[model samples]
Target: MEWFLFQLFRTELIHREHPSSPMRSTAQQTSSEIFLAAVKRGAKRRARLSQKILAAGKIFSTPIASGNGEYLIDLSFGSPPQKASAIVDTGSDLIWVQCLPCQSCYTAIRAKFDPTKSSSYAAGLPYQSCNTSCQYNYMYGDDSSTSGALSFDSITIRTSTITNVAFGCGHRNLGTFAGAGGLMGLGQGPLSLISQAGAITSKIFSYCLVPLGINKTSPMYIGDSAAAGSDIAYTPLLNNIVNPSFYYVGLTGISVAGKAVNYPAGTFSIDTSGQGGFILDSGTTLTYLNTAAFTAVVAREAPRRPTLPWCFISLVWISPSLPLPPENIFVAVDTLGSDCLAMAASTGFSILGNIQQQNHWIVHGIVNKQVGFKTENIETI
Candidate 1:
């Protein structure tokens, strides 16, 4: 579980790769075409996730907005290290992969992971209710699901290997996974990779998200190596009893171009029932604000022409303020330089998404109950 660095690629870019080539070519499409396509897909993903958050209320369940992840990583599982790709998701818990003997599976997957081929694979757990093997079933909001035996095995990322890792060997997987082998859950839950390997990771990790259009892989650091440096800015990490897996933050206020936007108090606060709050999620592509706050921000910033090169939107997190440049707040809609707001209004809760996180070294300091941020040129890492 020693801290290690691994490459993270956009899912769309990976899909565009030719079966015989490792190079992730865009199939000759222009950068604008790829960016616009990603934006449209992100809009669909946002709508699905918003629906689940609004309807779930206090009822908690592992919900995967499958096939819509913005980023993915390549890793290996079991002995001999059979290569596999998984979606890196901070919104849900439970690491899983499609196993052999799949009753129903997505045809897009290159190959099914056969647990029997690995010598280190083990089934069942002490807490499992089954007499012989542990069984797991996860249902998503979009009617996608994976169900199979709960087991443990060796997982390798780069040169770092961790043994006896808990994961679900999915025998029945049905969904639009977009050719991914499975999902790597980075949430704050017992089944998440971070929690399962907490002894080594110290429940801490950090990542630098690159833009979707960029073909270069981004870097992800885990364990002690992810510790924030002196230049990092820290903010309180709130806990939600209703949904403990999510990483919640304190969003106090917002300002556009140094001008404060008037919004009602507690607009971003998690209520006693855990109804509304602000969360930082890597799986979500675009940022989402609560209806009231979203309206205020749009009304304040919308008057400016979209062609402007500068739009500094600062998000006040308790005592610290994180300013987002125009590139992070606005997305290109056409080659003519017309841009659109890269955020949406949410009826349930607000989320700081990946688009708003590019080029920033974000550290999730779980043990200390605080998240840290440091601006850096991630491509140089």
Candidate 2:
């Protein structure tokens, strides 16, 4: 078993010649403009995901890929360890990478993984011991798809090496990955990297997201290092049988300032049909609340800052009262010259996105089925 720490960088920083360069865009734009654009894009993508989940009435076991997510991590695969950059997605399962003999792949990818080059590469699961290769086809909600063989190899994260890791060797992949080779799925699913490497990771992981535009790499801890500190708050993770991959929390209600926003008893709960619930998603940039809840919260917070239409206060989650400061709740829109709420309204499902998670040391205690949070300056950590 191995445990170590690694760096988590935002995908937008990949092509930047300098820290201030525009993210995911060819045109010159200010940092504020880039921030606004990314937030809007994430909100739209999240809406689509919510709809897809509701339409299917369950979280897809195959998992949907969010193209060019906000954060990514560098990983090394194979025996000697071939380097590759992959999106870090807590919303999806299945760690995969673009492999050689590609039917279709992103032209921007500088290096395509050649499994044959690795001495440790194996065709399928070790338990299977079958002569035939295990094939997989993953279709995302946004039409992006990847078809590959279920393969085994060594994956290196920082200095720690985890052997016999299961990952997809994507022969055919189609998506706007922004040069990323593939995705590292951290979702609570059987096929997720955490689950596959449970023996070494101890089914524990934690990450502290740096504030946007900080030009700093965040820290992700695995195994014993990921345990919650004394100052952290613990919340039981709700189980959604239909959508078991997602991390659902017990959200009683939200409060603006000291006042609690009015909403129904089970507004944030997953119904018998698994329709509506609140999930913590690392892939989504902005937080989303159920329409009714959103309206109530906004109505209370927006009135405080009449001059700044978009300005809103922090959200205090009841029961445990996890407070998110204004810095984590708002995004500066350069054009408007005012901060906008980094939140949106969803029809049913709600998400606690990355923006709201900034500077928070979030621990996912998989074995205990709990999540812990503590405020900390991520850059220092």
State the weakest 10-residue window (summed lDDT) of model 1. 7-16
Which residue segments of model 2 deviate by more than 4 Å?
1-26, 57-65, 126-131, 225-229, 306-319
Q: What tens digits encode model 2's per-residue C-alpha lDDT throughout 1-381?
A: 334443222122222213432224567678786677677668766865765567655443534635567777777899788988787778888899999988898664448889989999999765656445889888876677888899989988766688888899999998767667888898889889888767666777887877766767666776653343467777888888877888888788677776778987878878877779888987788888998888888788767765554343544443365777778877777656577788888876889988888788888878888888898865456
TM match of model 2 to true structure: 0.88
lDDT of predicted model 2: 0.74
Worst 10 residues of 2 by lDDT: 8-17
Note each model's CA RMSD in angstroms: 3.8, 3.8
